[model samples]
Target: MRRRQFLAGGTTLLATAVAGCGHPSVVLDMDEATAADIANQVSISPEPGSAEYTVVSAAIENASSTRRGRSELFDRTDTVRIGDSFYEVSETPLESSEVTVYEVRLDFDPADSTAEIGEIAYEELPAADRQRLDPIISDDNPPSGDGYDVGIGYGTTQEVGDGSVFVPEQQYDIIVHNGDRYRVGVSTRTTTETEYRYEATAVTSGVDSFADRVRDQYLFTLTGLSEAEREVVEEAIDGGYFQDDEAFRSVTNRIREHEGLDVTDSYGTWLLEYEQVEYLTYVEW
Candidate 1:
C-alpha cells in the first residue's frame, strides 16, 4: 500500500538537503523596516534562531484563478532571507472553507544566520522528493460533511470530527479582544457534546505582551454558541457576509476581503468556489 502523506501547502517540507556545502549566493538584508514590519505583522514569539517555534508570514497573495485559495506562503526550510538571517520555513494550513490558511513555521539556530541552500528548481529535486511536493498545487475541493463548522475568521471554518483537532504546524490568527489587538494560534482541540470550553491564557510576548490570550488551543464548539451567536452567523450567510455586515462591507476589511470573489457577488457564493487543499496535514477523526 502506498504510504499516505500530506499534500502541498500543508506541513509538507519542500526542501531537504543543504545541497552544496558552499557559501550562500544571496546575502540576506533584514535591516529594512519592511523586514521588521513583516516579521512583526506575523507575530514571532521569542526571538528567531532560538531553536524554538517561530511563526512568520513571508507573503500574502490574494486569491487568484490559478491559486483558488488565499495562499499564505511561508519559508519552512532555510530558504527565504529574513532579517539578516536564514531560517527554516514551515507552512501549516490552519483551516479551510471559504478561505484556506497556511501557517508558516521558522526555526533558527542563532549561529546559522548565514545558512546556505541551493537555488534548485522544483523539477531538479530527486524523483521521490518531486512526488512529495506535487500536492503543493493540487485540485482538491473543500469538504462539506456532517459536523460542526466552527468559524475561525477569514471565512475559514474548522470541521470537527472525532471530537478532536490537531494543529501540528503553528498557524496564527489576528483577532480583537477588549478593544486590543492580538495574535492567536491553536495547539490542541477540546470540546464536548453540548458545551464548549475556552480557557484564556496569556503566554506569548511581542506585539502587545499585555494582550489577553487563550494559548495553545482556543476551545470553541458549534453547539456551545448561544442562540444569538448562531443567528448572527446565519444572518451573515443569508445577507452575504460582505454585503450587509458593516464590519466587512468597507474596503478596509482585511480578514473578509477576497480578490477572487466578484464585488457584486455574495460571500455565501464561496461555498461553490470552495476547493480543498491538494493535501491535508490534519485529519478529521
Candidate 2:
C-alpha cells in the first residue's frame, strides 16, 4: 500500500494497493471535502479534545483504508456506497487500555468495495485482546442480551457544558471472569438525598449462545499497575468484589488510597474518583 503526497492544496489523497502478477493496483482518489464528509459520516473527527483514542483510530483507518479496503468494514450491513464518487465511510470502535477507539475508513471506488484483503482480517488479534476496543457509540435504550440480564442507569453527576447544549451521562460496569461467568453493575447520580443510585445483575452466557460466542472477546488492561497493585486488583476479583456493590466500592477506595504510585497514566484521572466510573456504557449518552 502506498499514497502519493498531497498536492499544494492538501485536498488530494491518492492511494494505491500493490498487487501481484495478474491484478493491477487499485487507486482511490479523494479530495479533502470527500475525506472530511466521510469522517463526519463515521463520527470520527480529528478535531481536538475528542478523546485521543478516537483520533488515533480515525487517523490510522483513514490512512490505511485509503490504500486498500479493510474487509472487516464489510461485516457491517449499514455500510453504503453513495454519491457520484461512490464514496464509502465507516467507523469501527475498538478498546485499548482505558479509552475507546473509532476507526474510520473511506473508499472512493465501487469496484474496490468487494475486494478481499486477507491481511486486514479481524482474526489478527486474539479474542481477549479484541474485546478491549469499543465503538463509543451510544443509544438511549440499553442493548439487550438474550439470556443475560441487561442493567442500565444514568449518573446523577452533571458535567458542565456550554449554555446551549447538555447531554445526560450514564455508566455500566461489567466483569467477565471467564467463559461462563460475568457480572454487571449500573450507576447514576440522583437529586435525592442519597445523591446516587445503582443496580446489578449476574449473568451466564450459555454455551454456544451469543454471549458465549463473544465470551473470549473480553479485554483487560493491567498495563500501569505495579506488581503489588496488580495483586490487589487480582485479589479483589478473586474475592468476588465486582459481584457485590459494597465489596466493589471497598476495593475501589483501597486502590485510590495508594498514594505511593500514580495510577493516573493508565487508568485516567476518572478512576481517582471511583464514583465516576461505569462499566458497559460511556460517560455521556
Candidate 3:
C-alpha cells in the first residue's frame, strides 16, 4: 500500500515489549499531548543521512513486519540514530485484532532532548521489504470470518459480519519516561472502521445560533429541554461561557444542580440517548 494510505489506518493501543536481557519490558502508554508533540516534529520528507531518514533506514533494515506474534525466540534488536543519540529499536507485531498491529519501540538511553521520530515514504522502501509488508498493510487482504471484539467509538457504530476490518495507518512516536532511558515509539490501532456510521439523532448545523453551535461542536442535543433550562443554556452560550473550560464546567454544574440536565462540559458523549444511523450527515466544520 502507499504511505498515506498506510497512515490513514493508524489507531491507538496500549501494549508492552521486552527490551532484552537486564532491561525491563515497558508499557506503551501514549497520551494526546505526547502524541501531538512527536507528530509536530515528524519529517514526511527528509534529506539522506539526516536523523529522520537514518531512523527510517534503520527501521527498514530491522524490518520484522512479516512476524506473526510476540515470541521470545523470534525477538530481534537493532540500533537507530535520533540526532546525536542512538536508541535500541525493536518491532513487535501483535495479533490481537483481525489485522496485525505492529509496535515499533525505541529506547532512549539518558533521554536526549534532540531525539525525534517520523514517517518514511513507502516508495523509499526496498522492493523486497515492501513485498513482505503488503499483506500487513494492504486493504486487498481481507480478514477471515473471525470477528473483532473491540467496541465502537462515539458518533459511529460498526456493522455485523466480515464487512468491518481494522486498517493500520501512519506510525507516530510517543515519549514515555522510564528512569534514565526514556521509552519512545509508535504502535498501530484501528483509526478507520469501514462499517461505522453515525447515530440517527445526530444532527449537523452551521454557524447559525448559539444552540446550533453547541450541537455542532459538542454533540449536545437540545431537543428535550425545558423552557427554563433552554433559556439558561442559551444565555450561557450567548455570554461565551462555553468557550472557556472553567466557565463551561461551572455552567454545566449549575444546570445539573438546579435544572437536573444530563450534560457534560466536554465533547463526544451524547447528553441524551439517540438512535443509530447507517451514515453521517456531511457538515462543514
Query: What's the lDDT for residue 55 in model 2?
Result: 28
Candidates' C-alpha lDDT: 0.25, 0.25, 0.28
Better of 1 and 3 by lDDT: 3
lDDT of 2 by residue, 129-194 (tens): 233322211223334344334432222222212111111221112222222222222233323221
Candidate 1 overall Cα lDDT vs. reference?
0.25
Give the per-residue lDDT of model 3 (tens digit) for 1-285.
111111211211000111122222211111111222222111122457754354445455554223222232112213232333333344343333243333333333333434345333444444533444344334333232222212222111221222212113323232222222223343454432221111111122211232333334333223455555455444432321113334334434432333211122321112221122111111000
Who wins the TM-score comparison?
3
- Of models 1 and 3, which has the larger TM-score? 3
Regarding TM-score, does 1 or 2 come out ahead?
1
Candidate 2 wrongly placed segments (more than 4 Å): 1-241, 264-285
Off by over 4 Å in 3: 1-97, 110-194, 198-205, 209-254, 257-285
Clashes of 1: 18
- RMSD of candidate 3 to the true fold? 22.7
